[model samples]
Target: MNNKTAIVTGASAGIGKATAIYLHKQGYKVFAGARRIDHMQDLVQQGIEAHALDVTSPESNQAFVDFVLANSNSIDVIVNSAGFSMQGALEDVAPKDAKSQFDVNVFGLMNITQLVLPTMRAQHSGKIVNISSIGGQMYSPLAGWHYASKHALEAVSDTLRMEVKRFGIDVIIIEPSGTKTEWAGIAMKTLLEQTPKDSAYRDIVEAYADGSFDGFSDTPEQIGELIYKAINAPKPKTRYQPSFSAKMMVIAARKLSYKAFDRRLFKQFRAMISK
Candidate 1:
């Protein structure tokens, strides 16, 4: 790992932060990117380089790539982890809200990946790790728009992996279950505001919001560890399902017919709300 240079987006907190610190400890030249530079002060003190990056902006993405390439000559790994969730039914979600989710989770990730690809290709070797969610594969009754964005990401990552393999650049996807992050709290708040009682999906929104308020999310570090393995493994798998529940959920979704899956999901939603 010491022989490589890694650029981790969203490195200020949660899984991104954990992965950055872990890479640095393993002797890699780690560049941590996030909007809040202060959150990465601790990393700088430990010899990791921190950069302010807003992945939604093309200028910011290009600038980050330029800075890293100029300083290090090459980047061996890139982790795209700058994303958030906004929960609500599709009808309850405003167009602006849905667009905003895609702007950050999908477009922003693509911007950075494209910016870094030229350099990676020049080096003839690189790895791109995209942090998707279990929500990407299976729909969440509450987070419809957010799930749409992740589902789009799944397609993007799949296509990119195939497209870049010939370049010796491996693209890996990390699918995490409900990990414990500030994301859920923020998502729940948005759900309430965006899907008020007057909305058609109010009942489902309320049910999901209540469930999110209760404790059901996993820690971000679990995803971080899975990400670390994806980066360092000699022959990394194309897709990694990090959380145990996340894995099971994907399996269950796949095993069940669409009607059965919908029935089970709705039942789970009712159970959550009753509690």
Candidate 2:
């Protein structure tokens, strides 16, 4: 036993899976969670214990924490990487889906965090890293609800960081720009399937689906490395944006006025849709 046990949600694939692998290599006992049991066979083969979890369910959250506790006394770290993003025009998005997005990305994250608090508090040391997107800080057309969930997560992380400081527990947020993952494809497909086909915004939606969207070279393993760094830091920062493009976007968002940022983004999308 490494004596350090970490739980990583969203471990089925992408960033979450990568983080689990990286953390295990770093010598921590890794416990991974996701809704897709079949998808986590790779994690299990790597020797990381995999649990079926739904972040939105309180019962599921409790069971996950309990299982970890039964096997280990200390809960050293947890990365709330489970998330969802359904892209569509705001007016066309189903209200239930919008709420569901936040339920998983925001409130569901809180559910696990709250469940782990007592254990972490008892230990007087723990780290909670939230996987947020750069989209939280910057917005794009046809992705309003996705952005809103991330924005809500950022606010929650900020407030939790302050509250948990005295408990010797650290809260960190990871803001990724673009990564080589299926997330974009999934989001793009959702946009097309869920949005009204006749909506005038179909042009940009198809533009996204056809892959004219601005893409990046960032990979899930890179995000894993960043999360590993944040976990190991003696004093971790509240926010870590690992990708250079992510850093630039964050800087621009901070430096430019909202109107300026909107104009720049609008021009880019306009050109793409027109093409």
Could you say which candidate leads in lDDT?
A: 2
Q: Model 1: which ten-residue window has the lowest total lDDT?
A: 210-219
Model 2: colliding residue pairs: none
Q: What C-alpha lDDT, on a 0 to 100 scale, does residue 226 get in candidate 1?
A: 74
Superposed by TM-score, candidate 1 places the C-alpha of residue 274 at a distance from the truth, in angstroms, of: 3.0
lDDT tens digits, residue span 1-275, model 2: 46799999999989999999999998899999999979999888988999999999999999999999998879999999999987888988899999999999999999999999898999899999999998878887778999999999999999999999899999999999888888877777777888777898778888767764466778999999999999889999989998787899999888999999999988878877777
Model 1: residues >4 Å from true position, as ranges? 213-217
lDDT of 1 at 14: 86
Go through the candidates in order and give each one's C-alpha lDDT. Answer: 0.85, 0.90
| lDDT by residue (tens digit), candidate 1, 41-156 | 99999999899999999999989888888889789999898996777777667788789889999999999999999889988999999989888888857677888899999999
